[model samples]
Target: MAQVYLHTMFGNGARAMQEAAGSRASYARMEANAGAADMLTDREADFIAARDSFYMASVSEDGWPYVQHRGGPAGFLRRIGDNRIGFADYRGNRQYLSAANLAADDRVSLFLMDYPNRRRLKLIGHAHGSDDPATIAALMTPGYGAEPERAFLIDVVGFDWNCPQHITPRFTQKEIERLTAPLVDELDRLRARIAELEG
Candidate 1:
């Protein structure tokens, strides 16, 4: 399974290197055993629900790759189907590089990271953009405070989970507060006990 992901990544040169490293046979075994799915699993859906941002990559006609960070309220990226997802394209610096690139080439890649959990997901897809007001409205995040310029829809080709080898665990402000709440409460209790003893 996951032939698309492996095939796209492993060109002749890459394959040659893998062969030299004796990994080609192992990768071949993996490809034979692991087939790609058109739909997300329940776990993947939940992971997507918890993500507030992701990095997207698009390619220009000239073959240059552009990476952009897309962020909003959690769950801003709406899954329309098992194999489909979309988001409201909010107004930004107006570079329109991604939109322009998509016009030339539909292929796209996405990287979603959960730093605290040290998990990452990579997705490959073809993207379509729509300026239809209804579509934009449907995808827009209700209280995200961004103006929707259009809607970006992705028809997923495949997805893969990456190993957490080098990911540095980092906490957001909200995460830090949630994780330390119990400790803070214990500190308060200890202080109160000390005051009672002194009295």
Candidate 2:
């Protein structure tokens, strides 16, 4: 219900374009009416908890932006506070591109997609990586196999739920199983009934 995300995303040029189209006034009105909060709502926290992966965008010193996919067990990204979330940065391909970019500029954005449900959340924030024991412990999931090299903290600026209009529905293996489990059970029962009748 908030337009903080839109306000931050739209620049003067963008607003000018919208103005030429006579949409700026309507957008400004909506922005004024929106209740933007610095903290994540309970529903947002729950959505973040259910996500297993997210795409992180970082800008290099050359001004080129790179999007890296980070994933782990479900709930790897933990909500540390009302307005902050963190995750353990496990050792990966050794590219170190994201870490280097973050050092130069902390501003980053995250895209979390729940494809099966056709939902998505966009988060803009500042992120930093640290090897501090306390931070790592706070973010790391004990049962997750990967050894964390450092803890990554995201101080959320704001987040927005995206329109699902073009997001084609897709299901993960786990989601597929969960959805078809009852049907599988029913088929097994029918098979048994046929076998018993033949005997």
Candidate 3:
């Protein structure tokens, strides 16, 4: 039988051959030893009470990956059960890359970052879409009306703390200074012009 070949943007056929050979060799080495440690560790329920944003990743039928951002109030992510989680899928622009990918493949990865605390959480799970009234109610956000066109229930297999050492912490002082400096300067100039006008 003739061998079939696949091409990618990395390079010509030679690179593909090298990558195939390298992958097999790498897999052999990895198979010799156990894999890395489990991603998640136990955390206080209150820990998630502060996060308002999460990044969700899903894969298309063709194996391409898509990531989308979901954000709202604290505890937007609720523990449905042990090893299970639920979050609202707020209405957005008609494009639903994550939802479409979830329909094709249930597996997903989620990342949550609490910027003020410099903390992060990563979750790996299987996702299922739902339109049930109860499920929708559980995931709804205030001012967001009811459930979106669809929502997701994730059967979490792993939850992990993302390292913060590499992430530089952002302080409110610096943020305020950066945001208000120009406005403050402009206000001072305006006040000076008003004083001149009154003088």
| Top-lDDT candidate index | 2
Q: Give the higher-lDDT candidate: 1 or 3.
A: 1
The local distance difference test score of each candidate is: 0.88, 0.89, 0.68
Q: List residue ranges in candidate 2 displaced over 4 A.
A: 33-37
Where is model 1 poorest over a 10-residue stretch in terms of lDDT?
30-39
| Residue pairs clashing, model 2 | none
Candidate 2 per-residue C-alpha lDDT over 1-199 given as tens digits, one digit per residue, 9 for 90 to 100: 3577777777899889999999998778857754555469888899999999999999999999999999998899878898899999998999999999999999999999999889999999899998999989878887888889999999988788888999999988888999999999999999999999999
Clash pairs, model 1 backbone: 1-34, 1-35, 2-35, 2-36
Candidate 3 lDDT tens digits, 1-199: 0011011112456555756777644533433443332322236245655566688899988898888887777778777676677877767787878878888889888887766667777667789989887787777766755447766898766555666777666555656788889999999999999999999
Q: Could you tell which candidate, 1 or 2, scores higher by TM-score?
A: 2
Say which prediction, candidate 1 or candidate 2, comes out ahead on lDDT: 2
**Local error of candidate 3 at 93, Å?**
0.9
* lDDT by residue (tens digit), candidate 1, 1-199: 3666776666899889999998899787766654565457777777876899999999988999999999999999868787888999999999999999999999999999999989998888999999999989999888788898999999888788888899999999999999999999999999999999999
